[model samples]
Target: MKKEQKESLVFGSNLNFLRTRKKLSQTQLAVDLEIKRTSLIGYEKGVQPPFKVLLQLADYFGISIDALMRYNLSKLGEFELSRIDQGFDVDITGSKLRLLVTTTDKKGKENIELVKQKAQAGYAAGYNDPGFIESLPKFQLPFLSRNKTYRCFQIDGDSMPPVANGSWVTASFVEDWTKLKSGTPYVVVTKDDGVVFKLVYNKIEEEQSLLLVSTNRLYEPYLVSVNSIAEVWKFETFNGFEV
Candidate 1:
């Protein structure tokens, strides 16, 4: 989609969801807004409404323009898990949602989820699925940061050396992709590449893609679009000992 076209896509779904919630038909809403019925329909289809008209709609709906900007229609109760704006759901933090299972320890701290080496494939396929995440084994790691969510990944190949094969990596869930530093390592979950541990660079400004580089220079870096991304975890700490 053109740069202008991308931002408008979320508008249609949000408008449709909120309108249905209020039990207002398009024609009735149009009458309320004092606009032509077709004009309202165009807005629902993601056509950019006039600036003044857009503000009027926001005021009429009791929402802010910023709220409308991030409004994903995925909150419309559970049907079947599809995708979230071609990504994952943005949760209460105004950041991407992570499937975290928690239990209080003696110190009342929550345990982090661990994805073992053998279970890597399952994590790749089921990372987005609530049921799948619920079934994974979780344990408490004392050294982790208290307020953040994290996961343990079991690596397979030598693609990322100095970190070797059959070792577990502890990565914190990254909610905001924009804050990611260049040359940082991430365990990025994607639809195309399953689960990968790669060095990532931000290229989201130039193109809607991220540059994934391998630690081992033998492997070539490639571009993966933001749409194909499901989840991104920033490397925090790792245990090189094979368990």
Candidate 2:
């Protein structure tokens, strides 16, 4: 079979499985997505969909487009399926059961993967994909503790002063968000915002959100809903020179 056909097979299977898992019949799902029931049937029979329709289906299923097309969702057990559920799909939550995907060096030491400006968008969508993480530039920071996982992100704007544009911030992964200390700087990765370096104020308890602040007085603070946050990295240190 052609590569496109093969991929469509996976997409169709995933689409059918997800729709059935939600207990919605083809007609019901088609109506909700505003597409014809016949078209939905075609999709389930390995017919390729328009980009817009693919996006609509992915959104309706609460999954990323890459995952919907590439992953074998039907093969996953309940525990593994939960890893890609809505909460985990968008952002890593405070739950201890949640796991972070990472890379390691030849010696089995964890590599500090660098998310460059170009890869930020891809990272947001593919953070859970091991292949995507492995494709990024990876390095090791000897000074950082081996017990904690670390990732480096390249900064782009002046919203946070002192951290210059073009600089890279290496931070430790924050698994338990409740340990967040207000006023501490972090590199927060979100579904909408992509990636940003800010001083985070924990509001998870009170509002199920975080108040992200910028050092530059010109920029106003904003609250990011916990559901949208994909990952949080506590500011351990940075590698950049002042302009």
Candidate 3:
């Protein structure tokens, strides 16, 4: 009846169907997932599991969260669907899947979205929600949209000084960590830090970490492992409003 209810039903039915198709009994599937048997029952009964468990299920079953929550998984192409399960880095754009970063404007044109200061905390949680991403303040910067999809974030604090607090920094998504040039400014979101604008050095070569150097010498550089990063946006430009 309600949207959440509908999604839960779709997810539950899809879970059961996937398990059956994999020829795994409730107990077997539960064991494989390392979750209690009754937990599986509850999930199959339309009670949505926690986000961590949802990720585990998607990884274990080799399916995208999109397909895992679908009421009709058969509609997706085999090749596209199979690749979605390959790894977390699967580029959904290639398959035209809206797994993450569903960029769309009110008029169906590609528009740059803004992550307002108030919206930073929720970005980690709702990044996958098409509604939430679409609802983010949308506008366009013709200069940055030549051939890339950019998202702007309103930042605060004095870690990277002179940029001005409340400045809106526009950035393009960094698909390959290798392409990140050292001594570049980026607004990288990590599992630990919700969001930070930093001048970064690419240490992803020798060590699987990044040297987050601050331009303001008052602050010290720190290391962030490659694995801990959730989203990386290479800084392009910023608009600082003088207060």
Best by TM-score: 2
* Lowest lDDT block of 10, candidate 2: 88-97
lDDT of 2 by residue, 122-211 (tens): 999998899999999888878778889999999988988798888989899988776789999999988898999999998764455789
Residue pair clashes in candidate 3: none
Candidate 1 per-residue lDDT, tens place, 40-123, comes to 888878888787877877777666565454445444323211332333332323154544434454777666777877777777
- Any runs in candidate 3 off by more than 4 Å, and if so which? 1-99
lDDT scores for all predictions?
Answer: 0.72, 0.82, 0.74
Q: State the displacement of the C-alpha of residue 223, model 3, in Å, after optimal TM-score superposition.
A: 0.7
- Cα error of candidate 1 at position 125, Å: 2.4
RMSD of 1: 7.3
- Candidate 3 residue lDDT tens string, 121-185: 88866766788887887777766556666888888777787687799898887766756889999
